[model samples]
Target: MLRSGAGHPDAGQSEASTSRQLSPEEEAQRLYATLNEYLLLEHKAQPRLCLPNESENGEVTTGARDGAAHVLRCLKVWFDLPADVLINAISLFDRFLTKMKVRPCHVPCITVSCMNIALEQYAADTDTKRSISVEELVSISQSACTAGDVIRMSRVIVDKLSLVTGCRTSTVLDWLRLLRAMLRLHADQCAIVLPPSCQEEELVQLLEIVCCDAACVNTRTSELALVLLYYKLEQQLAESLAAAEESGTIPEHAYYLYDFARQLQLHCHMCDTTLAHARARVRHVLSRYERCEARRDQRQRLVWRLSERTLKVLRPTDRLTSLLPTIEEQHFAVDATPTRTRSGSESSENEETSDWPRSPVLPVYCDN
Candidate 1:
């Protein structure tokens, strides 16, 4: 967790009065350094989009990333895991992909393993409920990975990144906490009411939704949280003022709009122009997501079936089938899509990996 007023101390009445004597510039500078302490978790490390091996479809990649994230969200809701688990899981997933090469077929496995790792870390730190076992996770996610695969992948990820690194990096939640405090302090200074209508859970849910956007993968969490709050508060303020006008009554937070942004920018070191662009991007992404959601809702009412040709090739239970090789399926098969090494030679899975049940006479994996 990002400690508030980190590396700083509280003061008594006399000391507090002395602090009040500082100039505005000095105060802002002091607060800025304190706020920036939240970003101590490798701020230089940014996670970017990782394309699947030999795949060119950007839509598929986006869909895959979003789809995987949605799986984590569902798991969180299903298991009643803390919000930290979901955010940390997504961080692990993004960072792991950014740090290594992963095949498209392995995406589901990788995603689940990341979630499991996060869940374990969270549970260990908080001493909460035990994580879902590897077998159950594979079954629930329908990720097609074997229990062994999840274990191996989890080990690989942990070996690559430290356990705390996922949560150590500032997340949307951390930024939201900081911005909320700043907003509250500014509202008090203006002698205006704070947000009366916005609930904490609502704000949390909105930020979580915003984090789901592909654009946010590498975007700064602080800016995303700031803009999200800015838009929400601005909307609430407008609504309150309009209602107050119609009702001939003063609304709570009526005067809170005065110098609303000064402290946020000064304390958080934000650029107005950059924030504006990020807010626009987030707005566009949400609009697009809502439209997609509406379409999905409509489609849910209708029965859509695969084409006869597709059904002929795909079994009804194909989605539920495990992708892991069984004893009979473990013989070395020629890579249908061979990858090239830097030496410019074709490399295939046939180039010895883990010990497998071998059959010398025939290919275990039938492409057909």
Candidate 2:
């Protein structure tokens, strides 16, 4: 992460140094305006339809395999996105299709309905009638879905998620982050550190449930940042704990999970790449711990305080400080192997002015 107020010639300083001198405030205003413009452009460029080549089957059809293929086509047309997001979407679609057996022609309607359900859950308390505008969905696909069908499908999607995970977007995000975090902490421990062999698999199943919930609709909550960050931290701490036990590189401390989570939040941005890296680390740790803790039922029992009932939300900036170790203090710097990079436009100038917002920092902890 690059610092905003650093001494690297003040960024765009070169343009000003050799030419007409604009005041600092004027420069600042220009920067803000430029940033706003870039943001708008990126928003416009955000993926609405999946890549065309992947779903180029000529015309929609029926029957078992064909129905599956047709649904995939509808998915391709409706906000075709990356694998993670798509996996979630498909889960919702499958759930509804299995129960409702929506016709091939109605694919568009169901797609819209699913998206609206997600919008409602995520946006909450808003007039969802205008929530997922049809224009945006239609504009993206050559074979667009009807407005009526979209509305219909949303109802079913919502019902399914409500049943599967109590219809709470926050819970889903919490579970996903926790699983990702635990996997990051250590996969080996999943078999050994956690109380039972089923612990890790159970969490993964929860994530699948969430993904299925989000799929038909986009229902992730505002607290997603905090949820993700918490997962990342828990995972790293788990990994560090196990690694220390083996190599003696770091000392093992009881209930050190809180401190580790805090440290990651302080030093790292909660970007997807950072989260993914954290997840990978946890996966490695779990795989290793499983071999040694194969017989121990309670070896890796680090408590994570994620429930809203137990934890208090802190001011976004104070998230890092809020998670400092309560008992013994051990400090360490994380050498993260770069796992995330901007999607496109690698020019130095373009990279410098890219409009994406840095991931917001949020922290939460159990109320002791």
The digit string of per-residue lDDT tens for model 1 on 1-368 reads 33333312221223556656754455445555556676565363357764543457432376678788899888888778778778878888887778776667888888889888877866665557775777888887888789999999899998886554323455666567656655665665667666764556777787778766677777677777777787777777788788889999976556465356555655567788888888888888778877988888557466667674565465443233234455554444576654545544745554543444332222257778
lDDT tens readout by residue for model 2, 217-307:
2222212323334444466567677878898777444234444444444433345565555445444444554565686874768876564
Query: TM-score of each candidate?
Result: 0.66, 0.29
Provide the overall lDDT of each model, using Cα atoms, as 2-decimal numbers.
Answer: 0.67, 0.42
Off by over 4 Å in 2: 1-94, 103-105, 125-132, 141-143, 155-171, 174-249, 254-368
- Taking every candidate in turn, the Cα RMSD to the unseen true structure, in Å, is 18.0, 31.4
Model 1 ranges with Cα > 4 A deviation = 1-34, 42-45, 50-54, 57-60, 129-131, 164-167, 188-191, 244-258, 292-297, 302-368
Which candidate should be chosen as best, given lDDT against the real structure? 1
Which stretch of 10 consecutive residues in model 2 shows the poorest summed lDDT? Answer: 44-53
Error of 2 at 289 (Å): 24
